[model samples]
Target: MGEVLWENIIVSILAFAILYFLLNKYAFGKLFAIMEQRRELVVSQLDEASKTREQAHVYVEEQKQALNQARQEAHEIIERSKQTSNKQAEQILELAKEEADRIKVDAVREIESEKTKAVAELRGEIGSVSVKIAEKLIEREVKNDQAQEELVDQYLKEVGGRS
Candidate 1:
């Protein structure tokens, strides 16, 4: 019975070695190759994902720069408009002032002309009154020189006072 037990033990050990050798040569090699292929696929996918993430970041940055540039251009346009509006306002004010000055000059000229005309008419009336007075005195024919002189002095005084 002891010898049979020892023999059974040896046989079992031999069977385990053959099975391990066969699995290492055929089944384990294929299994390991499959595992290596899966690892390489996962690494390539991770690299692709990283590259895509970097591209997305660059796109976001470019959009932000474009937005900032657009805002700056809009601000410049508004500033230009304001400057143009101010220039127009100043030009209008200057034109108005010039017009007012021209009107004032015209009014002064008109007043001066009217004054000159009035003075000439007054002089003509004075001349006509002097002629009529001389004709009346000649018709009266005052004989005394002293009386004529006194009458002339009195008329001169009256004319001066009226003027």
Candidate 2:
């Protein structure tokens, strides 16, 4: 009975030791290796994500700078267009002023010329009428050619002065 008990205890200890060694070598060690691989993968993934975030931030800033440049260019274009329009308007105003001045000058010249022509024509007509009237008056008063010519000349001078 003593030998049998001693044998059972020894066998039990050996079986437990063999099972612990097999679990450490096969299942537990593999599980530890898998955990390490998973930890390394997670850390590498996190690093990649950080780099991507930084790149995205830089790209966004670049886009913002481009937008600012576009805005400045648009403002410049608008200012240039405004200046062009103002210049055109000034040119039009200048042309209008010149045209009006030219028209006024032409009108004044035409009026002066017409006035001169009318005055000359009126004086000529008056002189002829006066000469005829004086000749008739002298013919009735003197009944002589020399007296008629003198009277006509005097009356023509008087009519020219009145005119």
Candidate 3:
């Protein structure tokens, strides 16, 4: 009975060795090749995903920089507009002041011209009245034109000097 048991143990070990050798030579090689292909595919996919993530990060940073630059440009435009408007306002005010000064000068000149016209009219009226009064007082018409003109001139000088 002991010898049969020993023989059965040896036969079982020998069958296990043959099965392991066959599987290593045929099944294991194909299985390992498939597993290696799957591993390489997963690694390539992961590398591609990492590269995509890096590109996405770079794009986001570029967009952020562009947004900031746009904002800065907008701010500069606003500042320039403000300065331009301020200059325009100052120019408008200066033009208004110059126009007002011109108008004031024109008004002054017109007033002086009118005053001179009024004074000349008053002198003429005074000279005519003096001539009429002299004719009435003397009870005669003055005959010499030169004498009458000289008399009127003298009277006008006296009156002008007094007032």
Candidate 4:
């Protein structure tokens, strides 16, 4: 019985050793190579993903800067337009004032001319009436022409002084 048990244990041990040796020689190296390749591939993919995330962050920052610049330009344009409009309004007011002053000066000159014309016309009418009255008085008094001329001159002088 002891011999039979011993033979059985020895045979089992030999079978396990043969199986372990065969697997190590044929499959272990290939399996380890495949696992190493998978590990390298995973590491490269993680590095690419990190680079892409950094690029995305840079692109977002650039867009924000561009947007801020555009806003500043728009504000500048609005301010310039306001300044131009104010200048135009001031110019228009200045022109209107000049025109008003010119019109007032013209009116004053026209009024003075009209007053001079009226005064001249009144003087002429008064002179004709005085001459007619002197002629009537001379016919009644039998006066000489020289005496009549002297009286008329004196009367005209008195009227001129009063005016």
Alpha-carbon TM-score of each model against the true structure: 0.64, 0.69, 0.75, 0.64
Counting clashing residue pairs in each candidate, in order, gives 0, 0, 0, 0
Count backbone clashes in candidate 3. 0
Write one digit per residue (lDDT tens) for candidate 3, span 19-110. 99999999999999999999999999999999999999999999999999999999999999999999999999999999999999999999
How well is each residue in 1-163 modelled by candidate 1, as lDDT tens digits? 4356878788999998999899999999999999999999999999999999999999999999999999999999999999999999999999999999999999999999998997887788778767877876888788888878877787787667656
Q: How accurate locally, in lDDT, is each candidate?
A: 0.89, 0.89, 0.89, 0.86
Model 4, range 32-145, lDDT digits (tens) per residue? 899999999999999999999999999999999999999999999999999999999999999999999999999999999998987897788778768776676866684578
| Predicted candidate 1, C-alpha RMSD | 4.8
Clash pairs for candidate 2: none
* Superposed model 3: Cα runs more than 4 Å off: 1-4, 140-163
Measured by TM-score, the strongest candidate is 3
Name model 2 segments beyond 4 Å from true.
Answer: 1-17, 142-163
Local lDDT at 57 for model 2: 99
